[model samples]
Target: MPNDLQRFVFVLFDGFSNMVLASALEPLRAAKGLPNGPAIDWNICTIDGAPVTSSSGLTITPNASLSQISNKADIDYLVVVSGYGVRDHGTAKVRARLQNAAQHARHIIGIDTAAWILGCCDMLRGKAATIHWQELDQFADQFPDIAVSQDRFVQDGKLITSGGASTVMELMLHILTQQFGPAVAFDVSNLFVYDAENQYHLIRGADWLQGSGGDDLRRAVGAMMSRIETPVSLKDIAKQAGCSLRSLDRVFHDNLTMSPGKYYQMLRLGRARDLAQATDLPLSAIALQTGFTSSATLSRAFSKTFDTTIRTIRKSRAIR
Candidate 1:
């Protein structure tokens, strides 16, 4: 077998989210176990060699200090994992390291709140990206030059940014699929128990919800969105909205041009797509988690609505 170990370096900072770090690392570990043995080599690093503590109090000792790394040309990608103290951690030295690394690495990936750090370094200037939802407003307010969205993940050429902890898995899966064949990525996903096939929303442009208008419609939409995984009946939704079922139906039809049931199904399918695309979860698991009665039911419904099978969707995402 050819030595195809893809080298990856992850830079962790103080108060980073451990789940985000795991989500990024686990897929690579699984990929290493592919048919020909380990296919990837990864190393953890910190700005300093000192142990770094995660937001949840998990401590990890880096393999090396960022300042000690030699030729960057040996690395395939440099991923920066950022969280709570993103602003404090974005010191001049850290930014300089990132800027210098970007010059040699094939791509730069930012997880969780690190996208803000990338934006601060001017790496994301005029690039489309996404960060954790909590930081969206402030990130946009601060980096007006970059196009920010609410997507699970966004990849613009060599720069990639993910929105949350789970998004890291999706981003890595995307990279794996691109480097290896979709079949190998799918096998790696199965080893990790992730759903090998899923469609993730990458473009979160403002126009996504163009038809959803007014405060009442927005509230109704929010209620519908929150219940996608375990949808409630229209009467129950109406009670939640403090309005009659007829009134709610009329509002949905007028603004969104779809029945509440249909809209709710769309929301559930969207969630299903995200779960399927990012992880190695089973179709049945995705269906159950997203509120489908059974995998068979979900397959029929998914095919009818999206004009494709769930398996096909998952395979396409895995390869892409």
Candidate 2:
């Protein structure tokens, strides 16, 4: 693998959703357009390196074939993009090709119902994964061993599965942030106007506080997310939000149906959970990073909020 370039191969199936493909592919293009940008190379691929028809009747020409990349050693990510009729095109040959390519890739990503294909190949077994919400029941029933979730996306080690096209952009931003830095990722997001979508919350997956509201409420939520590593008190949060404590509490209750204190706890817990699942950090380090005084405190709060132990969550994310 060349250290100068981060190469990605997007395996697009017949009848794939073009929107989903674009969501995952466009961010790399935008990221590379930045000044002194990172060297990110990507290719659209298919089973035979031929033009494949999308669900909306558009055809995309493949840059490489499955046979061409199965033995390659320079690939960094292999993203499978599928949506409607994913099962019809998930042939045995494609599964085998993906399995072989996994040996040389750094990470494997599943967009939309592509997780169904990965699950069928036994590639997602014992990993934290998710699919589109509409297919949650079927996906769970089909892949019993995989820890399925309704989350926007789940990153267990080198495996990543996103819910659908809506969340795929966030997944790419996360990859950029992890590889380059938040500054580049933020700039890429700004170019796409994605940062303004969530009112610049930056914590995209926490849906508990999502809604159209006044700036005071948005500022409070932003403050809570920003201070996860060194938490400020509710009074301080309200002050930063330019609102009184009672007003902030009312805003939280009206929008999220939870008090500011409860929402802040959820934010911290969500960050802690993300770190626990995605990184190899020790519990003490995660606790400190999330503003808990000690590991024991984090443990108790985590168990109480999630109704499961942190050890259990980490165990489920153990990859083969």
Candidate 3:
């Protein structure tokens, strides 16, 4: 890996959610293969240097214990992946190790019930945070000082918290989109055949982009999603989103650093890629669904965009 890699340290408790861990980490794995994707690496650890079992009985050995995490100030995000028995892992010793890790990390993320652990360490006080919906009421009652939200995920400054597995995936993708642009993020989403319709609207994904993406951004992305099967003109998209074409362009430009036309094309191509990777649909059918007039046009565009043909990806996937 390059020295420029973004390092993530995953501190997993004994009952960590396997689904949530996979959702958080798999996108980072997929992102590395895409053009201009994030240069990222991760290490999984436990409170002690021991193997931990997931809620579903999957056992994972740690790269190191929390004490082994270097305090070189190179850690980008210290992610806490939690599960049902959250309190079971929240001993004073565990909190001390986590607090030690937090000091070296630039940011901290709590997935699912991990927010409780973070709160126990006083890391989330005075910040808007969330937890797995199962513990929301109890968490709110426990920590009245912290702003509690029922949104899919919350990113207040360096403290990030998510609801569950799917929301964690959304949070990861939103991070990808923020850092690597919409195209790479879109490809990562399609790699899993993940449909994000109405999901972004669910994201307090907007908290960070309060000023830039603003209200118009979601509206514009929403409109684009609704017309994925039959793409409309940029003007029509802007009109449907109740914003001017210039405002729509500005939204994409400011947030994604890409033109609206480019983002729309990428979005449609992502749909085509999803079809190619997961379905045996004919090229013409795929093209029609993704707003390409013909397979020839789609083939050329896909080759230009992804640097691999639909046939190549299909053959590769088949061999796997």
Candidate 4:
């Protein structure tokens, strides 16, 4: 709502990966909590004013249809998240609409098979880009004039292209790093426990992490995520993460600016918030799932951490 906010329009098609969309958007959501991070706003859109289902069968009701995206509004970024059935989704009708949207968008990003769609719109005319690796050969043959790369994500001028879910996250963090700084990106990546996985380099090559002791913090956070329902002691968590409790505390303090116990509580409360926002399960069930002894105890902690009652938040979500 701020005047300096950057507006992002995400155009999602049928059979898109909700995970990929989350990978791209969650970093920006986390960045908003930073003291001086890039201020941004975003909307999800579809080709028509209809709900579209992801490849995993989750349906999403977008904020608006592509046609509703008036060119009068300043469009700072346009990200197209495409997955299965990408070829058919990029029809002439869709291309026309996307071209009109791009005219005002300062930065254009393509995820998964979205590069193909952008190419169809002539948005990536001379940009070196990539798509999901499965379509690398087809992409090369189809667009011989456009130089293709096997990297996870590539940026040329104002256009960006990403391969898959993990790369989408990397690309987003890259953008955050460029727009704000690496500290903001690192903090956001740490929130998601990004360093626990070993499979990220399969497509993207080596990681950007430069052994700055972030891996240890990520491991500790990963341990916390793993034991959210049965919260663990700082000593046990440090041991699981191959560090001493004191070292773990220092890592948490230095990197996250919180004590280990405090971070753990925040993690558990975050899980509670997600469950409360996204599910119909009762408070007792939610409390049990997030390691709370009872609904009353969970309610107090949730209200204290989030500064809002669960009932009020749920009612607000329903109203929206």
Candidate 5:
């Protein structure tokens, strides 16, 4: 709606995650807040231009109906934000509206369960996309034509799909980087206190570790992260990070209140937890991926750290 600005249209549906919507929109908001920043305009829209309710019982009023913007050249991107019970609310009219919008928009991005709708419309055919981890199995099975990834976000061709929430922030930052520059993106990340290294994949409790510790700590953690599948020894981690084993131990003690080995194990276990929950991969495969020598080792470490077995966690999530 603003003049001479990069325009984005976000299609909201019932039960959408407010966090995902905010994470995607906030970077643009931060950019606009910057002094003499370039213009970037966005509008919330629905199929019928009505108010939509989020999963958390929050209501959002759309700026315009999907049909109102027929001149696709005016819009830079169209994103669909849906959640929880998306399948229940999606109608033929909604699909038709998206199909019409896809004809005009430069790119179509899907968040959370929106990929399911996009797949239903046959828009993701031959494209690599990702959806919320919980739906990955169903998505792959339901749409044989789509290439699904477990990455937090996937941008294949003109189509972009994000897993959800925090991942949406990464997607938005990427969009900003493309539209403006890395400086703008970096500044925007600072505004949100976001860690860019945690882009699509990240450690579980490492968010708090960001910028609090010294560079050596960050470097050591980075090294550990980069070698999750084939874990490097602590001596190697310290050496590559330009620190002694004792120095690395002290840094971890001061920052994370644990030894470097324990912290790195947690990181690997975190990755194992993610893979175990998000993927249909076998326990043995997950073990190798997360640096455990065997499935039994992974199970023992997982139970020790989380106080629950990986199988139990997966089963509970499956039941939910």
Candidate 6:
């Protein structure tokens, strides 16, 4: 790595989410691709230097041990990517190590369950944050001081957090755009064939359904999620719910505070985001698979909603 490169240290714990790791790292790689691009450096690390396995059984070898890097002053960011047994890893030793790293690092990022680690480290106290949807209840129960939200991601000053794998790529792209200009970020996105306009959101599964107007709304949302590749219209969803379009709209307003059409679009976009962040599928293919008529259409709508492009989303994933 170049001497002037920004250094990023991604902390991996056992049973980490591979998707989160990919979402966090890919954008940095994309940043390096731009002409006269600023140098960016990243390395994977664990409590020890030993290889750690992902929740999906993918094993990754770390570049160095935490002990070696904990006190290093050169690191710019220390990102903890965790999943599953996050509470189990909240050992005193790990907490101390994180605190030591935070002393030197310019920023600390937590993805998915790793947010729990940050909370346990007392780094997220009183900060507005989010975690994976499934763990929201437990997270609140354990950390009452933290103001958690259902948003896809949250950034409180230098401490950034995402709900989980879904929001990790979005968070990374946000960082990339902030560090590198939109033009360089766009170039990086182009290489990945991602739509250039979709802003990333950190979504928790529960939030996706919360406030949905009762069983009718829940069923509509569920059907939409299950059939993202073949999106159904509001009218169709309303028919399935044995309600008229007007009734559907009223229910949606009562439950989700959005029209049925908007809800469906959000559902599709959410699924599209997950695929973009978690898979290497071409942008066009992803668009088609997510029920968009074309990549351009998806790009337009996604950008309108997310304020970023698809290319950036994919580029972010690529860095991971």
Which candidate should be chosen as best, given lDDT against the real structure? 3
lDDT of each structure? 0.74, 0.80, 0.82, 0.80, 0.79, 0.74
Q: How high is the lDDT of residue 298 in model 6?
A: 91
The list of candidate 3 runs beyond 4 A from truth reads: 1-4, 194-320
How do the predictions measure up, each by TM-score? 0.59, 0.62, 0.65, 0.64, 0.60, 0.60
Write candidate 5's Cα lDDT for 1-320 as tens digits: 12358888999889899898998888899877553356888888888999999999999888889888645345688989999887775578987888888988888999988999888777999999999999999989999889999998999988999888888888887777677754456446645653424441342223333323456775776688789899989999999778889999887777545698987887688678778778989999999999899999999988887777888868987998
- In the range 124-217, model 4's lDDT, one tens digit per residue, is 7777999999999999998887889999999899899999999898898887766665546665776665444343333221133333455676
lDDT of 6 by residue, 1-320 (tens): 13376889988999988877886787688667443467888888998789999999999999888768766656788899899888899999889988888888888888888889999899999898889999988898999999988888888978888877547766766666566544344334434543212211222222223343455654555555566788777788777766778888887776545687886787577667768778888889989888999999998988898777778978877777
TM-score of 3: 0.65
Better of 3 and 6 by TM-score: 3
lDDT of 2 by residue, 186-238 (tens): 55665565323354545432222334445677677668767999999999999
Residue 124 in candidate 3 has what lDDT? 92
As for lDDT, the candidate ahead, 3 or 4, is 3
lDDT of 1 by residue, 1-320 (tens): 23666788888988899889988998788767432334688889987678999999989999987656625446788899989988887778888988877776888999999998898789999999999999999999999999998888998999999977667777777676577644344444444542211211221111122233334444555566567778888888777666778888877676445687886787677677667778889998999888999999988877887677778867888789
Q: What is the full ranking by TM-score, best candidate first? A: 3, 4, 2, 5, 6, 1
Among the numbered candidates, top TM-score falls to 3
Query: Poorest 10 consecutive residues of model 1 by lDDT?
Result: 198-207
Pairs that collide in candidate 2 are: none
Looking at model 2, report the run of 10 residues with the lowest lDDT sum. 203-212
Poorly placed runs, candidate 5 (over 4 Å): 1-4, 71-73, 194-320
Error of 1 at 50 (Å): 2.0
Off by over 4 Å in 6: 1-4, 195-320
